[model samples]
Target: MTPFRTLTAEQIASLEALGNTAEDWSQVRVSEDFQPFQLQQSRLEGEVRIGSEARIIHSRVRNCQIGEGSLIEDVTALECRHRSSFGNGVGVATMNECGGRTVRIFDTMSAQMAYVMALYRHRPQTLAALERMIDRRVEERQSEIGRVGRNCRIVGARFLREVCIGDEVRIDGASLLENATLCDGVEIGVDVKACDLIAAEGARIGNGSTVERCFVGESCILDKGFTAAESLFFANSHCENGEAASIFAGPYTVSHHKSSLLIAGMFSFFNAGSGSNQSNHLFKSGAVHQSVHLRGCKFASGAYIMSPALEGAFTMVMGHHSYHHDTSALPYSYLIEKEGRSHLMPGANLASYGAVRDIEKWPARDHRKLKRDVIDFDEYNPYVTQAMLDAVNILHTLQEQDPDAEVYTYNKTLIRAASLQRGLKLYNKAIVAALGSMLDRGESNPRHNGAGRWIDAAGQYITRQAMREILDAVDRGELTDPTAVDNRFRIFDVHYDDYAHSWALQVYASLLGHTPTVGELNDAIQAGRNAHAALREMTDADRRRDCSLDMAVGYGLDCDNEEDRRRDYFAVRGLK
Candidate 1:
């Protein structure tokens, strides 16, 4: 820390002449190279320390330490009344609004940490240990004086109290920001009203949004009048013109529609279409129920569901559903309401062009400067393959039980006979293709052991045993803080490919009932290639529907002839 010197007699006179007033001249301190002329029409009170080249113009700064090259211009009031942690230790009641699921928000909180905190209540001792680690992190942030870091520009802001601004941040035209930690490189834009919030590095909270008790992750964007309270939003999430309450939104969760309300749910890699909604209260009890939509799930326009439900990965939900079905064992499927009944088309999304597009685009769309959360972008990882494996067996059993039935019921969702047959084949094909891809990686030996149940931790795929070991380390008092836990997660990320290979080998051995010979392995590889080609062909055909003649109806509205319409349509929607 650079030493601060009391303002000189001449410097005080110069500041007074420029309409700057200090409560006590002795209490005001400045850096060795501080320029008195830089401050204009500002009131400094209660131990203000100004760094070199920092300018406080037309602002009221109280009990604050302004860093080098920082400009606090055209502000109303900036004050720290008491010792503040700047939104650290603020508990966000995520997943359950009425209580029972709350995550402590801190400056360095990652998605994986929050995931364990909110969802691992079954392990009470582990949750207690994790909470202690977070408490220690929050204690480190407590300070009597608020700080504005180097090169930050807070312009046209009104009423900022107990806010800790980090390096290179830009706060413009914000209104009533209180008790918030704006991390390094954060941008707070026009008319944002935030309280008890932690905006992580490279995050932007702008466009008249209202956020309270929220932990905005790195590179996440919340804008366009988005209102959120008691929510935990993770890396790369984008929300605009929507409302989110009590939601544990994992990485890449997006809700852009004006009429969407995502509440009391755990979601990751999800997209909420226009008017998407979910109800957690059935009126029998206070709002206590919660829902889970796994990775790559999408809710179509006007989609609604009651809580106490679980959706599978890459499942597309449409219409209203209140039956509270669990489709977790059926990945890449469609759950749509047809004729007032829930219809489940298991593994139907495998042939969807949109599903393939989503998997391809997530990695490219990540905007985080430092990706602390580990993300496995493989669409057919061990977690998803396990779901597919279960789906195949379930389909086979259903077919055997009712050979002539037109519709089969499972988990209160109806599946047509033809849809079941097609889904079984699709699931089998996907399993073979995924196994072949894993075999081609050439991993003879793996470092991390992957056995037992697999889970998708936000975006990363890992064995449940590995997650439990991390918790055990925490409970044993070895991993003392959040940083130590993050380092372990990083190590897991580094060895992800090797772990996946080991798990795939186990799956292969289980299928063959013994170690595969060289000839058998070669045959399996060829069969996987064929299945992959077939699945790809189906998705390609689905893509062709985008350029069909019916879809081009609005493209050439003013065209007089069919030839002119064709030319215009081809110009806008080119054949790709």
Candidate 2:
């Protein structure tokens, strides 16, 4: 341990002059950089320990351990009632707020892990073991002194209790923050009230937001007085002026504008327009309803859906929907309410130009600059492809089982026979698009061979087979800690391409219904790549059409002639 500088009697007198008092004078640990002139009207109580270059003005702290270069100004109170791991192992009741639906919030909680915890309740022993592991972590984090990390600023805060603050954090104008763990580079801004939260690195919570039992992932923003409860928002999610409950929001889930309530839904790569909402209650006794909004879904303004509905990937919903629909086999389509009935438009979103840009721009939009591990951004992976494969199977089964039915209705969702056929084509197109990318990579590098079932545990994509190997080792006492499950996530976090190719290979096998020889795989790969290249060309043409001279006819008001118009178009569009 580094030695602490002993202050002179004159320094003690100077500290007394500043109206600063400590419960135990011997417990006060200052450094050579410490200056008495910097502290003013601050009270340190109950085993409080402070670090060098600290500026404490108009604040009172009890059992707090403040780090070097920290600034605590105009803070009402900072205290710890008891030993806490902040958010770890704290049970949150989601969906039915009743018993048996409690999920443990840990620092390592990811959307994929939470998915397993929430949906895999059928595996009691496995869940119990995971919960026990988290509880052990909670116990291990117990400390008498609440910690404030280095270079952090705690200004104008109402109250902070048992919170583990991280390096370079800023918590200003927060009403009440208790039992929360803030990782490095987190910013909690004005009028924020939170409890039992674990905000990952570069996460921001501000603008009068009220949050409880929430895990805000890296670079996520919850601002503009948004209210959230029992939600697990993953990387780069942004929610403002909306209410969310029991939402397992995955990467890039954005809901802005007022009166938007996302409740009891599992979503990823989602975008919600103004007044977008979901009804989880059936006007019944218990709110046990939940839904899954698969990858790249969007909801138009004033859109609503009654839950227990499972929507497919990249699907769009519009208008108020009282009738629940399970459109799990229909990707790149619209589920619209027409005259109080639902209508499905197949292969519509595939033509959307925005869809191409949305996927391309996600990597650039990441706000987490300090840490890369805390942020997850992937275009093609097992999670989405797995869903697509499942959708393909569903469509195939539906068509084969009811060959004669003109209209098919199952699980409250309706699909026309003709539309079903179109949906299959669209889904296959999507799969082929992914397969093309994977094959191009594989062809470019023949030495690498990645094959298997990928599991999305947190943001990491690991082969289920690899995970089982680790778990088997754990069961044999080769791996002692249950947190070894985290290793599976870490593997994919670093080696994403391996997992990607693995999933691609597995999906290819499933599509053909048998394993192909290397030569056969190559032939299929080339054909898919050729088709995908044509598709990409078409998409590029569509993109150009938006900014082309034809689309900019009204923009060049000052143009004299066709030449001037061409010049103006080039100037504004900035492309050939």
Candidate 3:
């Protein structure tokens, strides 16, 4: 369908002086170098195709199809249709009266800002059945010239009636956008405001970010006054300032300070310090509640949490706690707060050295480049040292079931009876330093038949009756189905697979009861590897006596001696 070029009684008096009113001007069509005074008073319908250095200024369209060097500035297109390899080298700038009515096609160039956020949040009966499918592509572009490709751009967008954009994307100075799908090279900064979103590709919506019903993946980064609702962020997540409701931010999730607030939680590589917050609901009934921290966790600066807690994996929390503490069996512990209470310090971080420098800086702060659809999170395993050896065998069976009870009253806080006998001698010297580093790495690596294979306390492997059938499948609930607890912690995270290290080698062979001999499993793996290398050399001599510079001495009361106050604090703090 290519043969229509009529519109020239001086372009019908320059389109009735720039306010086009066409009931029929031979179904207005232009190309063959169309130029009725560069056209004006726009109002065209069906069988309309304008190309050859295309330009349709002062707009009001219906039943559309215009390609070839495309540009429809000051726009308003209704009942749209155009699907040829789709609306080429596109560009639309609307705002000249009836600033709303859908049907836009900016074919392939990396999803135009995800179509201005899904064509400005559609619904006018789905914007009149997508403008009757762009008036059946203006009667098949009346004769041809539809294929505009070469660096497209849509600017000063407003009340985008119903969006669906893609290709070499870049929507500048956007103020209002409805619905959404800005995939490919998406970059919508400057006064950005999106609704019902779905931004993928190199996602970046900085300058005053505001998205609703969100779902941003790929290279994510929602900057500044970031506000999100019904959220879901994956990929390299980075949410600035703060405010996320119904949150689920997986992939390297990072929340830049500024009174941070992440609601209805579920995060990943998560780091929310400055005024970190959370607390879904506590109305006793209504707003329900929620909270779960699994991945390489950390929350310091004015940290606060409240929502039926479950924290674990590489755990480390600071102050504020509104009761509800369920350290999901205490993985890599440290949940502080002195006077006000809550202090369960098992293996006091197995002689600290800052929890072995946060387990040697989480595999060098893995900033995952790609390859991540989901399931694959191992922030140091043995399922958090077997929930810190079942909170040190439930604090040694609640200190042998209350040896004259009152060692800081249980589950309400305050645990000093010299921290419950130095947390039961630092949880039996961290379960004999995790059974002597699992019998010195299973008698220096001797798998089976030699009847000499053991491992567990964290060295890893499986036996002792496949860890007592995973604590009898978590006591018959078979890991309470969430896809059988994510496939029983993905078969206890497969590496050296023995039925994925036999669910913590059957909970350390049911905390060592039946079958234990190869010299009582090499003397409980050399007493948990010499009490985890003597609690990491007594937490590196208590962090070198809590970072001693002669412990400061009240910041050296205006220097004098002590080498002129250590050379006036290394000349105003130079050398450490």
Candidate RMSDs in order: 1.2, 3.9, 21.9
TM-score of each: 0.98, 0.86, 0.32
Candidate 1 per-residue lDDT, tens place, 1-576, comes to 867998889999999999999888898889999888889999998989998899999999999999999999999988888999999999999999986899989998888888889889999998888888878878889988999999999999999999999999999999988999999999999999999999999999999999999999999999999999999998999999999999999999999999899999999999999999999999998899999999999999999999989999999999999999899999999999999888999999999999999999999999888887778898757899889999999999999998999999999799999999999988999999888776655465655777678898877787898898898999899998898988888788787777777777788989999988778777777777888898899999998886777787777789889988888888888753
Higher lDDT: candidate 2 or 3? 2
Using lDDT, rank the candidates from best to worst.
1, 2, 3
Quote the positional error of residue 405 for candidate 1 in Å: 1.0
Candidates 1 and 3 compared: the better one by lDDT is: 1
Question: Tens digits of per-residue lDDT for model 3 on 1-576?
Answer: 444588778768766776667767787777777766444556666655565555556655554445454455555442234332222212121110111211133221112122222233433443333333334543343322122222334444444323444445566666755545565567777677876566666678868788765666667789887888666676667888888776666666788888888877666666778888978577666445666675556788888887767676546778887887776565555677777667756445556576577556544544434322223333223444556667767766777777666654445444555556665677666655554443344222223211222222111233434344443553454443223322433343343333323333344556675655568666766666666677778988988776667765666577667877766655555646
Clash counts for the predictions, in order:
0, 1, 58
Question: In order, what lDDT does every prediction score?
Answer: 0.91, 0.75, 0.55
Candidate 1 off by > 4 Å: 574-576
